[model samples]
Target: MRAGSFGQLTQDKENTTQVTFHYVEGNTETFTIPIPASEFQEEVLQLLNQPWLTFHLVDQTVFICTARLIKVEIKPAIPELQGQGIFSNSMRVSTMQRAAAGRLPMNT
Candidate 1:
């Protein structure tokens, strides 16, 4: 099994988040994750500055690793919703998309 590495999260593309892994004890391991559009909220953004983040592996095992924000490449344009925006068309779009995908929980 490979030990998870410590690093930061970056957008590898419009639909992917890349995890840059660096090992302090053994070989560094890295990976990427797909996140919901709602992940752009301010609360989540602050999480990027946290010292460490707890991750649950696919095996149900937990991994605690330090998150270092070495740098961030500024994109030429912000995302349509900038990962977070309320009271706008983007919010409406997100809702519609979720409903279409059958992700929105039914009230009854």
Candidate 2:
């Protein structure tokens, strides 16, 4: 999640694609599909070409009629840094070493 202005809610940039659809019936719905950052755009484009759009949520599958769609807003956000990289692991180890030696690691 990224910080914003005082009252703004932070959004998680986890590996997901946000697709907002505005139908002709004046209904708007947004969905977050679990997709990797590298393939977000291509996947979304493929999904949109079909007559029925399907999303697999946590407990259910949502189907949207693409025929009634009037507008769509697709945003492929920057995903958060996964802590599996070399720099992240090294930093974590360094911090743990400092704490073990009775020295407090400064927060970034």
RMSD per candidate (Å) reads 17.1, 16.9
Please, what are the lDDT tens digits per residue for candidate 1 over residues 9-56?
223354444454554554455544464334533234465566776656
The candidate that wins on lDDT is 2
Query: What's the lDDT for candidate 1?
Result: 0.46
User: Each candidate's lDDT (Cα)?
Assistant: 0.46, 0.68
Compare the candidates by TM-score and give the number of the best one. 2
Candidate 1: residue 65 Cα off by (Å): 2.7
Give me the overall lDDT of model 2: 0.68
